[model samples]
Target: MAARFSLTFDSVDAPVLGAFWKTALGYVDELPPAPSATRAEGLAQFDLPEDDLPEHGVWLCDPDGVGPHLSILNVPEPKTAKNRLHIDVRVPGHGSPDERWARIRAESDRLVRAGASIVDEVDGQHVVMADPEGNEFCVAATSA
Candidate 1:
């Protein structure tokens, strides 16, 4: 009962945000239960589609099983305001300030390419960004 619960996101198109976050956060889409597999086991396994197809509901899980799983739920309304609780993508700091900023910017660029838009950047501190759904999150540089 003490284990962390999955983070749920309310979205207009659940699968789109799910897929975006999957790539943005280096997560994988969770698969449904196999014919013979239990529910828990199914949640542990993921499917990689071999062909192009439109997805519906999407749930993302960390491949390393370190972070909480992210599930995007379809909602009728669109995002109108900022999120009260947001995730911070922490990139580990390695060397000097410039080096750390480089690392942070590199990650920021990658996420932007993956469908995130940069909201702003605070010098060498962090890069604030929003997901495809306009949900706000931060790419923070972690201390060494």
Candidate 2:
């Protein structure tokens, strides 16, 4: 039998990262309940009820084109250090480092505007970025 799992990201801003993944993965947003306080409260935040939340949670597809899901979750604590494991995204084509860098930058800019942070730029072949939750992901030039 095949096993399945959901990858979770501890995010300071769950809705932002969730929106990003929703766009990148074609996944729909699970509607959450309104906060207990009335809209005038201005401090009451709301989210999906535990039972109403999707079983799959929030996730996106593997950047490699592999079908594994990448899930992001909201947590109380912030990420204090670099991730022990990371995701690498390969742009599906071949090119020189400069060429690759240009493409990667274009894509990275899009992601940045969408709430991801560019952590670093290395050569023209790769760039390291973090999602709104702070989980690291890299974009690399690829022949595939």
* Top candidate, metric lDDT: 1
TM-scores for candidates 1 onward, in order: 0.80, 0.64
Q: Write the per-residue lDDT of candidate 2 for residues 1-144, one digit (tens) a residue.
A: 777755667676666777877654445543233543332232234464554333324545545544556556566587999899876766666666667778888778877888788989886668899877777888776664
What lDDT tens digits, residue by residue, belong to model 1 across residues 1-144?
676888999888787787789887889876554662543445335563433122435767899988998878776678898899999998975788898889889999999888899999998889999999999999977766
Q: Which portions of model 1 miss their true places by more than 4 Å?
A: 33-55
lDDT to native, each model? 0.80, 0.65
**Model 2: how far is 104 from its true place, Å?**
1.0
TM accuracy, model 1: 0.80
Which predicted model would earn the best TM-score? 1
Candidate 2: stretches off by over 4 Å? 1-5, 24-66
Total clashing pairs for each candidate: 0, 0
